[model samples]
Target chain A: MILVFCELKDGQIRKPSAEALSEGRRLADASGKKVGALFAGASCAGAAEAAKFGADVILTAEGATLASYSSDAFAQLLADAVKAKGATVLLAAATAVGKDVLPRAAARLGAGYASDVTGLSMADGKLQAVRPVYAGKAFATTTFASAVQTATTRPNVFPAAEKAGAGAVETLAAPAGDFKSVVKEILAKAGGKVDLSEANVIVSGGRGMKDGANFKILEELADALGGVVGASRAAVDAGWGLPHSMQVGQTGKVVSPTLYIACGISGAIQHIAGMSGSKFIVAINKDPEAPIFKLANYGIVGDLFEVVPELTKAAKAMGIGSN
Target chain B: MKILVALKQVPDTETKIKVAADGKSLDPADVKWITSPYDEYALEEAIRLKEGKGAEVVALSVGGDTAKDVLKNALALGADSAVLLKGDGQGDAFAVAQMIAAYAKDKGFDLILCGNKGLGGDNAAMGPMLAELLGIAQANVIVKLELGEGTFKAEREIEGGSEIVEGALPAVITAQKGLNEPRYASLKGIMAAKKKTIEELDAAAVTAGAQVSALALPPERPAGRLLQGDASQQAQALLQALKDEAKVF
Candidate 1:
């Protein structure tokens, strides 16, 4: 059997969870095995969603201890689930929580694991995964030598296919485990800012924005277009925006937005590596030769200070919002 | 407190990667190697902890002779010592983590630090894997951290927010980019680093559990079509393209 760890957020299943489920279903079909899903949370209200993505059996672990994410506890629960189900292959979305818990679980099971994988397939009855290395500059096909194999798929790289399944839900007792480190509190973004990784549209600024003050203009553009604001490493290093969360680059968040607007950002290779997967790119800068133009579907070689406000006005006139 | 920072050397971010004749590896002829950018933040945080609480910082890397240069750079940046786990630099993350965990097992260090992920492999597995192997607490993608007696508090960046997590001593923490500003090596520090020796260990100590069967570059994106005309005209044309061509809006 193959098990997929379906991730939930705000009482709903995340997009990446569906993607993982779809991929898991594909792998199971190829290997002639059943695909089981494990959902650990206080509430499994959205557990049925996993079925739409081809989860045969949904294993729900609901308890006070599972209310909040604890790496140690989750790892223990997942290890137990894998053992109980006799799962030969395990998959999860390579989200923040998955990245934290998967490795620990793999260690517990003594399984070979790979994270942020983009491709999954079965070769000679063995699980194989294609993962990006060198920050997406190259790819490597990896095979686990262990009996139980595990991998996490990067979000937005895989399409989530909707297929009807049995959708049977089973409640499992939360695995009893000791926790050393716990999440004390979660400080959310102040203004309901869309997450850079999940945002469909992103407007990014770089050092060319001159200083922190100019970021307000980019913010205005983002607001007008119902998009989120992001900063390149140069802008983040210069303290031009939210240094911790809003930065998007190789060292920061890897985003695959539907539309990416680069304003006054020189296209550094590192920055491009993060946003290169966007469906459409538009670059606006004063330097005509800025490398960003090379990657942009539409390039505006002009002063961003003038072009951005006009673009914002145009977007506002078109009434684009959260579409 | 004794702090050990795991470091890695990667090609310069600007280096254009070229696949070797073997079709399985990168051609190293024109690649420029430097300490992984995120690792510098780990080194900086270690140095800062040392400055605040009289600790010894030891930098460690798992690679060949070229990796020694990264350790030397760490030494120049204020690490008291460095160690190189000698290898061909082709081992998987599990093997590398096991080797480091083995070396650190007996060492009575209170803290371990590393980049959230190495640019070379883009594998964010080592730190957490190492922590699990050592049976200790760990926090990854940490943007802010404060160390206390036998415990530490860290704020890790998540998708839409940050989480404040508390872990006990002997914990492993991976440094995010904004954790701290890495300092440059001064002339005095460079001279001192030149005199420092880097310890080496054979990679045969640990075995790999996973192997790479093949490697290839991702398909190149098609060249973009640049719009013509002035800024206003370009903006108008862009809106049109977004609507008619890309259909993203």
Candidate 2:
């Protein structure tokens, strides 16, 4: 069986986790394997959604102790589930929580694990993984020598399949029911519809955008794409964008998407680490020599002030807006 | 209070990359090395904490001969002392973390700081792996950190939002960009860095379980085909590419 760690928050399946579930379903189909999902929390809303996405078995733990994420507790719960089902391969979304807990679980099982994987397949009864290194400038093909292989997939890179079904559900005992810490308050941005990390089309600004007010240009393009706006560390550091929480780079969030439009952002290696895997890269910068143009599948050497607005209008005319 | 910060030296982000003729590693000839960007934030936070709350900051780094340059930069940035885990410049995340964790265990520090991730090898695994190795509490990609009497409060970024976590003293936290503003090295500090003590320790015991098999540049991008239009027209072109050419979206 191939098992997925279905991450949840406030009774909803995090979009990244749903993408992982969808990818897991694909892997199961290719290898003739069973699909199982493990989630730890009180909410069942995400489980139903995972079922619709092709989960054959859903394992949930709803204890209060499991309400919040603790590396030790989550690792323990996942390790137990993986063992109970005799899963050959385990998958998780390469989100913050997965990065925090999966390594510990890999250590617990004494199994080697790969991270930030963009592609996966079963080859000759072993799992073959492809991941980017050196900030996406290079791709490495790696195979797991361990019996049970583990992987974390980048979000939005894999589309969620919509095959409808209600999978079997099983509730398990929560591990370490009482936590040392609990979330007191979560102060997230109010309009959560277009999270940059999960957006299919991301329009990002950088230092070249000049200031916070100039971000409106990227926002206009993002609106046209039905996606969220992103920024580089330089823009975030200059207070042109939110803090590191919204920054995309080596120190920020790693995002893989269908379309990543970088505006006025001289692609720093660190910035490329996060989004280099985006399927189609469109770089718009006044500087023709900017590093981003080297990796861009499509390059526009013009002022973003002049180009982005036109591009946004063109996108809307195409009627291929973000869903 | 006393803090330990781990720093590293890496090629400048804008440096032109070249693979070694041998195909085993990056070409070192003419490559300029600088302090990792994230490490600057770590050192800055450690110095600010010491200045505000009366603490001492000790910096550590593991690298080959070129690493000494980064160690000196750390000294100029306000670390009271420094240590270099001398090696062949081939340590993986696990090996580097183990060596640093072992040394930190003996220092009796109240807190530990590290860059959330480094450009070299570009794996963000060291901080968390080090926390696990040291059996210490950990918070990653911290956008905010507050240190008080025997405890630390931090905010870590999640996919769609953020999570606030707390841990006791002697914990480990990786410094994210907005966690603190890094300061420039003063002329006096630059001169004084010449006199600071940086002890070099042999690190043959550090074992990196994995190795880099080869280094190669990514496939060259296909020549760009500019899409022209207003927003709607561009959207149509992109959709066509997704369906007929790229087939990704």
Tell me which residue pairs clash in candidate 1: none
How well does candidate 2 score on lDDT at residue A51? 88
Positional deviation of residue B64's Cα in model 1 after best superposition, in angstroms: 1.3
Highest DockQ: which candidate? 1
**Winning model by lDDT:** 1
A1-323: candidate 2 lDDT, tens digit per residue: 99899887667788779888898888888889989988887555566667888889888887767666776677767778889999888889888788777665654454556676778888876677777665676665656656777777877777777765458998888775543333444556666665666677888888888888888878877787787888898888785546566688765666776789899899888798778777789888888899898888877777788778776776676665643
Per-model tally of clashing residue pairs: 0, 16
Top TM-score: which candidate number? 1
DockQ, in order, for the candidates? 0.64, 0.35
TM-score of 1: 0.94
